[model samples]
Target: MRENSCSEPRLRKSRLGSFSKVATTKPNSNATSENRVICIYTYDWTDVADVMRIRDELRKLGITSRIPYKSDEDTMIGKYRVRGDTRISKYYE
Candidate 1:
């Protein structure tokens, strides 16, 4: 008799689906104002990197920007946490 070895465990697939559908609210409209603030939602570290890249690009364009610290109450969306908030001049598109 030969002994068999398994390197990885098998994962069972769900009949319904791998993930449940999560209801998401539509994003708020971008309103123009003197000191406009845009909320950037980051699901993971990748999003944070994206925000940093955008910031660099904006800096090259000589655009003023800032990322303010957000409290738990202010940044919570359902179960996801908002990575950062981008504040910019009203003239920024």
Candidate 2:
């Protein structure tokens, strides 16, 4: 996956479905959807390259994968395991 630097701001959509430019930076430790902008987007399952790229990027940041669980049950399981030492939230899923 390509790293988006500050020069390349990403367009993120909020929970309300409004879009805005969010500067790409190392994620803040205290950021939350209720307090900051959270990006929510969807991709086609057939787009293997894009999906894999995103998964790899998250892995590099020490975030665990949510792939091996029973998501089909919709029990609101923990998606990823973000370490406490990292700036990102451990409960970020």
Q: Report lDDT (CA) for all predictions.
A: 0.33, 0.34
Candidate 2 ranges beyond 4 A from true positions: 1-40, 65-93
Clashes of each: 0, 0
Cα lDDT tens digits, model 2, 44-82, are 334455445544544554647453211212224433223
Judge candidate 2 against the unseen true structure and give its global Cα lDDT, from 0 to 1. 0.34
Each prediction's RMSD over C-alphas, in Å, is: 17.0, 11.0
Q: Which candidate is the best by lDDT?
A: 2
- Clashing residue pairs in candidate 1 are none
* lDDT digits (tens) for residues 25-82 of candidate 1: 4343432334434332223323445445544543544556554423334434422223
Taking all chains together, each candidate's TM-score versus the true structure is: 0.28, 0.28
Clash pairs for candidate 2: none
Q: Pick the candidate with the highest TM-score.
A: 2
Q: Report the alpha-carbon TM-score of model 2 versus the true structure.
A: 0.28
